[model samples]
Target chain A: MKILVCVKRVPDPETVIKLTPEGASIVTDNVKWVINPFDEIAIEEALRIKEKAAGTEVVLLSIGQKTAQEQLRTGLAMGADRAILVLTDQVVEPLAVARVIEKLVGTEKPELILMGKQAIDDDSNCAGQMVAELLGWPQATFASKVVLGGDQKGAQVTREVDGGLETLAIPLPAVVTADLRLNEPRYASLPGIMKARKKELKEIPLAELGVDVAPRTRIVKLETPPKRTGGRKVGSVQELVQVLHDEAKVI
Target chain B: MIEWSEQHELIRQTFRRFVEAEIKPNLRELEHGDTPPYAILRKLMATFGIDQVARARFERQIAREKEGEAGPGERAAGPEAADSAAMQLIPVIELCRYCPGMVTALGVSVGLTAAAIMSRGTLRQKERWALPLLTLETIGAWAITEPGSGSDAFGGMKSTARRDGDGGYVLNGSKTFITNGPYADTIVFICKLDEGNEPRERKVLTFVLDKDLPGLTRSRPMLKMGLHSSPTGELFLEDVRVGRERLLGETEDVPARAGAKQTFSQERAGVPAMALGIVSQCLELSVDYARTRVQFGRPIGEFQLIQLKLARMEVARMNLQNLIFRQIEMAGAGKRMTLAEASAAKLYAAQTAMDVALEAVQLFGGNGYMAEFQVEQLCRDAKVLQIYAGTDEIQVSQIARSLLRG
Candidate 1:
């Protein structure tokens, strides 16, 4: 099976990125770069399918700047065969990224495309569905567990919804997005890392892909969420009942 | 340059798979049987080359980042003496996350293998010993705890080492709960020397006693409640003799060369750290089960009471991790923590682990007590962290003494 596992680079969530005192862009002084947390599960699930299904070829694809290549390489180290760097220095809108990936969907002609449900930074859970729409392909979003088709035609995707789970079986040449319920990402070993560097990395430019990479919406301002305020304490059950009945105007 | 570059996560993954395949399936047999997965551990070492992983992370990574070139990704490591120890801790944490016994065996071996090279071994000794240590060809054990002096290892011990008529020292003593006692190829044992200093201050009597040494014998394994995969046993040295060269460091300057004499309570927090990791793992397992396991046609995790337990487990584990990780960094810096700090961390972490493990079992309901599920095993595993490394009461005593003195 030919597979393309889409990846992204994001700061480790545990990392402390200080904002300027005025609260503009983040303070980059001590921030450490890491693979997008959700994307790790994406890569892991792709690798899992590949391991189970024989004659599997996994191509890691990431649409971002050069730093994104590091995350792609990380996927490569975790057993992805090759990588494609959709190299762009600036932040592209989710739709543009989906379009760029859609462009490759024709040339690569992979049977399946695996990607994270959303980037933790933007938290925009749209790109996978948009890409699926662009390609006129079925999408199995928020997939926690996936089983490749026995006849090599499609896969059964188990996704976690708000209330419960939703299962779907899409035809071959489909897109799947991973949630945290998927497997944990494996670390790269010394030998695996060495081998990963040797894997073929085909860099695709935006102009060559015939796609517009500008964002439709601008991030007017970035700021931290306000701290939660302390709650008022009620003295007794009588006081609480009184407040609920009259002071709070609940009754 | 020391480059601690190894795929720690990969190793962790491999071990999890290994546990699922070899251990999880046979946990029942392992619990009932006498063998403690020594063979399996050797196989893991062979396949994973754990020593290489250790060498890469502990010895090389810190060395490289400390003295060699490092880009933005790598932070500057601390001084040479402590960096490796700190870096060395990652494997221990990862390994113990699944099973603590086999890793404990691996840990004791590391302490034994490195002591000679770090403290006193010649260039040739390093060349000869490094390969086996890396390959796990020969097992290693540290024999510091005598019958009398476990916590107060250097305080006062009756095990005496008298110089022979010709040369070497005749070692006469006993070491209990020595990890890898039955199969260790090399041993780092301490003995008391009849000396001129005060009786309370006999100083350190350290030696690198090879396993083949005559008069050395091993007793039966000490059966434990948990850590079923690690073989812990007693060691007997009835007039065991060693050559002058085998005595670790310059024999004449042995008093000052003692690692124990170097504010040991602070530097050696491996036992406590191991305890912390086990506790954290227990919390993780419990919280996971509580969330997934269901009751009343709903996920039990949805209930507020269960949510509180899960939240507390998270907070407790995080607090323990932060505390232990801080001390690990402190020890890595070769800084000495007061006895109270060490005792407090150990005491709190161990008890926290036991409490968490029990909560995990409670959260699991009937299955928590079953051997089939890991929660009960976690409960069994949690008890040793309190008793063996340093008893709960002993830690309390240590803390009280330090507090009283201050």
Candidate 2:
């Protein structure tokens, strides 16, 4: 079985985030890049699947600027066998990335594609589902448990929903998006890191993948949510209940 | 106190996982039952490379030269350069001191097993036998002890080796309480060369015997009180005829007088590092347990009693760690100690390990005495520290004797 896991490169979680002067993007002048925390869980899942079920290969797929190559290398160091860097200097939106990955999946013909539900940096939880739609494949989003189906062409995915947890038996050629509760990602050892430098990394440009860089949503401004002010307190429970019912109107 | 560089941190994490998965869980059953953790211990042999010592030695040599402490462009270690050997032994000592069983298994499996081939075997012998010992393909036993040969390991050795027809040697020996002897594929059997001569000077001969060789017999595992995971057993080398290729150090009559001098010097160097490792292990066990275990109102770690124990453990640990390193450096730099100095470090560190481990158990109280607790295992394991690699009494004797000679 061939599995393609889409990974993202994001600023290290240790680095505090701050907005730029225009407030449209982040101020990432000098911050360490790491595989997104959620993506790490996705990578671990792919590796575990390949380990438990024999004759499987995990190919890391990442889309961003050139630094995405470094992120892909990080995945390779953590035991991914192969990597594909989808190149684009343009601010590639989630739908565009999803389309690109879908195109790559069509070329590779992987049995399953796994990715994080969303990148922590952008908080755009749309790529995995969009790719599933583009390829007309079943998607298991926010997946915490994945058991291979008896038929080999399907899987039972357990994930969270609005009110409670749910399970979905999705057929093969499926896309899986991970949540935080999957598995802890292992750090790459020195030997693994050294070997990663010699791994098979194939870089396919955005134009080569034949997906156009198109943004469906444009943010004119980015601002913090307004803060709530202090509320007045009443002397007793009865008085507080009356105030809540009357002035506060929260009863 | 244990700080990992960014590069080593990854390896540390891997090793930590390895310990959790392989060592920590089974440490209880293995220690109590005296069942040697042969499989996992052997598996961990892959992690530490054989030439790590040589590499460390090389790095230390270069560092010292660059600092201009030694003469210009001098590659050879001189009398003034005894510090490098000890420095080279630092990592090994630190690693083993954390876990004595780990080092003992490694030493016997690799260090002792390679003894015969390294000391006297021919080029053919070394190339073939040495490789297996180095990679842990065959565990090796350095057979030196007899029922009565505790302190006088060589002086009282009862095992005998007689040269048989044409190029074969027949060795008859019963080596007791041999480390790795129960499981060793190769045995470096130390025997009496001539029964009539003075026992101390001309009687000893070290021979390498293969376990598969005929007439060789071994007892089942001996129940040990501590360091229980280290395989110990009685070995009966009953007229075992090993080929000429198996003999170590010197082929012709062993030249016992010369080899004894060299072996004692090497043993002196080796024992100190082993002692350092023991103390280091004790310190780690104490500190880690203190931090996690709670007492009245707060972590016992916050209490002055626990703090004092930890502080003393650290002091002992750091002192021995450096002392051993200096000894190694001294050996590497070609300034072998006058016997007394070597025994002093070993004596101090070994006693320190016993003391520290005892205090660690005290800190753990009732939990420390339990078989399940790590501190109890360590406490049991610490007993051997006082006994082996030269007993404390033997060390005191050697040092005092050496002082008299001075």
lDDT of 1 by residue, A85-142 (tens): 9877777888998898888887889999998999987799899999999999999999
Best by DockQ: 2
Model 2, range A1-251, lDDT digits (tens) per residue? 99999999888777767778899988888776778888989998998888888888999998878877777877887889999888778788888988888788878999999899899888999999999999999999998888986557899999988898999998898999999987878656434654666799998878876667778788788776566888776799999889889987998
**Model 2, B214-259: lDDT tens per residue?**
8999888788777776778899877787767666654656665455
**lDDT for B394 (candidate 2):** 84
- Chain B, model 1, TM-score against the native? 0.78
Residue B182 lDDT (model 2): 79
Tens digits of per-residue lDDT, candidate 1, B1-406, equal 2232333333444455555555556666555546665676666654444556656544563454346555112434474434344445655665566566766677666554554444444334444553466456778777767777776766756666787867788888889888788778777777777665665666566777777789999876777788776777888989887787777663646553346433234333565556556666767777667667878988888988888778878887677767755754665565656667777877887787788778878888888788766777767776777776567788799889988887
Fraction of native Cα-Cα interface contacts (under 8 Å, chains A and B) also present in model 1: 0.00
- Can you list each candidate's DockQ? 0.04, 0.08
Give TM per candidate: 0.60, 0.61
